[model samples]
Target: MVKKDTALGTGTMADRITDDEFERRMYSHDIAPLPKEMEAIFNTMPDFVVRPKSAKEVSNIIHVAQRKKLPVIPRGGASWGLGGCIPVKGGILLDMSTMDNIIEIDGDNLTATVEAGITWKKLCDTLERKGYFLGAYPSSAPSATVAGWINTGGVGIGTYKYGGAGDMIRNMEVVLPNGDIINTGFDYVMPNGSGYNLNWLFVGSEGTLGVVTKVTFKIYPAPEKFESISYSFNNLKQVGAAIHDITRAPINPFHMGFGDAMHYEYLRKVGIKAPKVGSLLTVTFEGAKEIVKYEEKVVDSIIAKHGGKSLGTEVGAHEWSSRSYEFKVRKMGLGAIPGEILVPMNTFSKVLDDTAKLIKKMKLKVPMIGSVADRNSVMVMPYYLTDKRKFVRSLTTMGFNKKFADIAFKHNGRPVGLGLFFACNVEKMFGREGSNLMHEIKSAIDPNDIMNPGKLVRTTTGFGFDAPGFAMNMGLGLLASVRSLLPRDTFGEKK
Candidate 1:
């Protein structure tokens, strides 16, 4: 039994917010919906939704929730397909979109401060106008919010050189679980003091520890020259070798990504001349003219050594400029479910081969795409296009996604973001000792369990056999059974 009015309904915070604003917040709840078939696993919805335009308002809302012992689920742009922003326990959905604002651009310090809700693309455009740019941004930059990506463990566009969003953040203002506002970095007057890197603790915490209100990110001067190059490989092994050699070299490409045959087929449908037989690797460089020239020479040498054929700059330029087109194509179907796993550079080929085999065995239609995180690891993202409204197809997609995660785990890979979907796989990725340490930290900071409960760490009480992992496995088993019963070509051929 839960108290309605006292815990969630119009109470003290109602006095500060208008009814229209509250209703508006409730209307725009989530961007992505869980598979219709997995209702039993994740069907929780927030009781109240509140949009806070300032840190003080956020503090007030959180304070009331704390007093009432209610869960506080923070939300940004809601662009992520994962269940990171969903309210599992359903209490107050803190919509941070209203906090969108670019606070400052410290030219002398080469840093910019902006409200967390601001989109990465907006920030990039703002910086570009001033001859500056972000070090890295996710593929969803156009719609994903700064804090959302920071909290979700962002990795995409510029990871090859600049690393993930965590690497770009210099400082932040975070509102702790108890509504206390603290600056992760030094005070404005003394911005370079030595202290525990608290800024990073909240970076990938997924709002379980705190809500990031504002962020200060390191910025760099806009490059004077930019170039894109493409290469073709006869097989996954060749592509893997090329990536490994390029990543291990002294050259630092701005971005490096590869796609399997299925991905290129989709690209071909979109009027791009992607090779049909094997894999396509694209690399982009941005810097001084001399640096770009040197990096291109090095990349070409590595590709040649790996038995890769140069496709020149035309294909690479088109692909780089139209990177977002892939997402558009993904959505063209009923819906696309993406499974991302980060694996070591050496095992990239092995993982790809294993996943391809699974996809083939399951008769799943998914396109494999990946980007080199750095010299040591790569991020593999395979998207399954399915009609979520169709139970059998949706179940098949979900089951395949779980299998992909399992394969990644077996190959020393972990999920890029531990949203509700990947929460159960934490123990497998990080050993028992590491997982227990994380749980301990979560308990210490959010003892009340009012912050994003049921995510990162399970909060729902269950019997010994009803652990989250067991439940997920059971669901996967059910899905597999249903899929096996379905007729061949029931979901139709891969588009």
Candidate 2:
């Protein structure tokens, strides 16, 4: 149990630092944290949240942290509700927000270069003026830093058309743990048969590998005309089938999302209403005026075949302007834990059915609202009945992750990435055998265990049967069955 009112603002190392120098460097930028937010994480409180104006300044801070042997957590926007931005080891919070600047916009080359801290919404605004756009439109667009989106594996409304954020990265300039700057991939239009494709490694590495200083990504020309269509279904089964058919169409959609009835009802309570509950599908298309109109007809045919009812309303041209701003709507004190799970396109229905059943079985007091991020990814925001109840607040993420992984594996789908720190305690997701392989990789790169020591790397510890938090997570009967499923050797082995 953490002390609720303890003044843990001061750590032993904070006292050792020269007061004059610390004070001088502290307020050179912005640093502010209220009591409620700071108290959530354990054993971590930054001495100062330092916002530097350039890559040189960022590299300098890393050098300073190394000299002091202080654990540093790099942060931007600070909009993440999870402990992603929290300094679990408690040292300096390196704020990269001040490094935000658009370095280049190659309209003819269809690429743009930008600093790490610019928000997605800001990027979109800038690109709209030039008639070019990027694909990573994660819900945190309004305030989330572009680097945060890349680091955390951003997926958004445009996924149906452009694919994941990792797919959009052309190259990047990163500041490593040793304070040396390195560019992962070549800055050319196409691959030049270079030595290796190191840029791909840092995409979802989450600041654990290095602090991204600059990025270059491919962009598309914005369509002059856009259309939004929402359809209602009597049940999720129909919604799933409708999406599958529409996505299989000859023409591609600009953006597409599927929201189950429960999600629509939740949105209704919050003053936004759509077609009646069982399921809702929103599809947007863009392109030449004639082409868009032609594809709209095919979409209508598919909808009719699936028995979808028109919601009697069309999202205006500006409707998707705020699509990425969904995070802001939920940030207003509504307790929600948004978990993203990716499954194979074929097994999507089974996974959803199994997940819904498990959520109901847990007797979770929170509403389980869900939406389809893309054909391969699903987003579920579990909401507690009340913000104060401990069980409801806990979100029971273990079940969703474990079950989803099983389904993904069975359907031949694999998890490419997950949002920040969840990978720290990610034994279950990777499992014992897989984690052993990860250990080997981590040991090779960070031989001294000096680079973000505990971020994504975990020791083998042999073949321990005990799953972290697994025993206490389930009810008595469920826990007994799970324990029984393991071999006795697993309980008494040291491999």
lDDT tens string, model 2, 1-495? 112122212333333222234652432221112123223433345555556666766667677666666555677776554445554445556677777898889987888898988887788889989888776577667778888777766566677678766777788888877778888775546444756567767766666677888888889888877788777778767877777787667877777666665554555555653345577667787888898888888888898999987653354232354455343324323344454556655677776676566555544433344445565555444432223233322333333444444445565554434332345334555777776776676556544433443354431111212223333234323432443343321111135
What's the residue-level lDDT of 237 in candidate 1?
Answer: 76
What does candidate 1's lDDT look like per residue over 1-495, in tens digits?
Answer: 234455534655564343244563443335554554454544355666677777877787788888888778888887777777776655677878878888888888888999999998899999999999888998777888999999987788988799898888878888888889888874233344576678778878888998899998888889998788888888767888888888778888899988878777766665665566588888999999999999999999989998998888998887787775565545445666788888998888789789878776676777788888878888999987767677666766577667787887888877776666556677777778888988998988888878887777553421112246667766765675566466543322454
lDDT of 2 at 184: 79
lDDT at 457, model 1: 59
- Candidate 2, superposed: residue stretches over 4 Å from native: 1-41, 192-194, 273-275, 316-322, 325-334, 365-421, 424-434, 440-453, 458-495
Instruction: Give me the displacement of residue 206 in model 1, in angstroms.
Output: 1.5
Each candidate's lDDT (Cα)? 0.76, 0.58
In model 2, residue pairs whose N, Cα or C atoms come closer than 3 Å (at least 3 residues apart or on different chains), thus clashing, are 261-277
Q: List the residue pairs that clash in candidate 1.
A: none
Clash number for every model? 0, 1
